[model samples]
Target chain A: MEHFIETIGRNMFAIFGVMALVGGLLMIASKSAIHSVLGFLFAMLNIAGCFLALEAEFLGVAQILVYAGGIVVLFLFVVMLVEVSKKKEGEVFQLQSRYAVAAVAVGAAMFLAVFRKAFFGVASPEALVLRPELAKGLDVAHQNAQAVSRGLFADYLLPFEILSVILLVALVGAVVLAKTERV
Target chain B: MVSLNAVLLISFLLFSIGIAGVLIRRNALIILMCVELMLNAANLNFIAFARHNGSVAGQAFALLVMGFAAAEVAVGLALVVALYRRRDTVQVDDINLLKG
Candidate 1:
């Protein structure tokens, strides 16, 4: 049973990886703003799945809540709220193939350089290693949630508090930017 | 061999393409999508490294990145809307309000 769970987890990680790639491509090729937003949402969802496979359930939930649920919806709302005329849609879809070729070239170079250090010995094994600590929390996923809370409050307390401050600033800035008049 | 590195490589490629598009394109929405793509790429890297290292920190960082990315998109879109209202357009070339 443990081995079975590991195999499922490994396979899920691969699936999430593929999904992320597909979502990225869709985001690039999407002509409409709505489509781009949807593509981004799909990509974020795949990343959340990756977080789950990495045994970071808290992060997965946060990804879903903040990204897929919050940001994409805001993007959709803004797209609808903005009024763009047909003539004003200039250069929105004009993608040059040369740039894409160059991007692919650069990506290939980076992949090749990192492939040796990262994936050479990976062997593509299907074996999953289930940590005993993770299984303790499986019965009730959110009952205690110690790893995340501990990390946030103790180890990462300073960064966490700083992030809250940044969030407040962002909220105020957003409101000011969106307001009709200068204040 | 379809290893974790392969997965990371693919994600990186997609992400770089997204970045290149954002840098080269003039469309604001597409640029925002590209930014999202870059964040996703980093997220993929975090997860891949987490799995390889057997640590949850990478995944936690990815989550944090996602939060910031979402907030960034919200602020970016709102700014875009405000820009549209002021200039009646969304082209990158036209945002020269303070070119003094």
Candidate 2:
């Protein structure tokens, strides 16, 4: 029974991972900007699936709320605002394709070779575990969101506060940049 | 539980796809989305590593990445729109004012 559950989980992870990659590909493959946004939306949703499968419950929900909902909708607004559909986009890919393809292909091959050895070797990476004595409260039984929130508001309070400031500056800058009239 | 190796593979592939998209695509918005894809891939790695290490720090960092990426997209799209307004082009090739 345990093995069956494990197999099912693995299969679901594969499904989510593969679908996410497909969506990412679709983002590049489609010429239409709106279509790319749609693909990105699909990718973000599947990535959220990947997050949930990994048991990062807080991240999974945040992924949906932030990436899938907020950022993607913002992309759609910009795509329409710019009126990409009004004009036919000639030459969807960059001019220097041959070099880019070669670079990406070589990089991908290197990565795969390294990952295969690292993952499948005698001492698997999964075996290396570090359950810190300090984080006793972060056990699996604890609710992930509560643990995460505690970590955020307690351990990472400074950075969390800074992130809010960054968000404020970014929003103001975006508005200033996009405004038609002089500031 | 999903295998750590499998999660790593997915993250790597997603990141590679994102790199390919950025290098291959000409549309500014598509490229921006690709950047987001790459960021998501990194988040996957952080979460998976967090799980493997039995800690929540990775999740916290992933949240930080999400927040930063959101801000990045807002600014990026704003720039895209601003460029569109100025020269009426979203293609990366056409907006080469810096080439001057």
lDDT (Cα atoms) of all candidates against the true structure: 0.68, 0.84
Instruction: Give chain B TM-scores in order.
Output: 0.90, 0.97
Candidate 2, after superposition: displacement of residue A18 in Å? 0.8
- Provide the lDDT at A182 for model 1: 55
Q: Candidate 1 on A1-183: residue-level lDDT in tens?
A: 999997866588677867877787777676676777787788879878866765567667777888777877787777776644435455655456677767677767876777766673544332222246544544323432465454445455676676677777778888888788756
TM-scores vs. true structure, each candidate: 0.78, 0.90
Residue A71 in model 2: shift from native, Å?
A: 0.8
Stretches of model 1 off by over 4 angstroms after superposition:
A1-10, A83-90, A93-104, A116-120, A123-144, B1-3, B96-100
Residue-level error in angstroms, candidate 2, position B30: 0.5
Q: Model 2 off-target regions past 4 Å?
A: A1-6, A95-97, A119-142
Per-residue lDDT over B1-100 for candidate 2, one digit per residue giving the tens place of the 0 to 100 score: 6677888899999999899888888888888989999999999999888877766688889999999999999999999988999988888888787895
Clash count for candidate 2 is: 0
Residue lDDT tens for model 1, B1-100: 2356665775776677677668666668778878877877777777666556655466556656766775687678878877887887777767788888
lDDT value, candidate 2, whole model? 0.84
Residue lDDT tens for model 2, A80-176: 8886456777677775779879888898899889887878323123411223543465554447786777767767889899999999999999999
Task: Enumerate the candidates' DockQ scores in order.
Answer: 0.46, 0.62
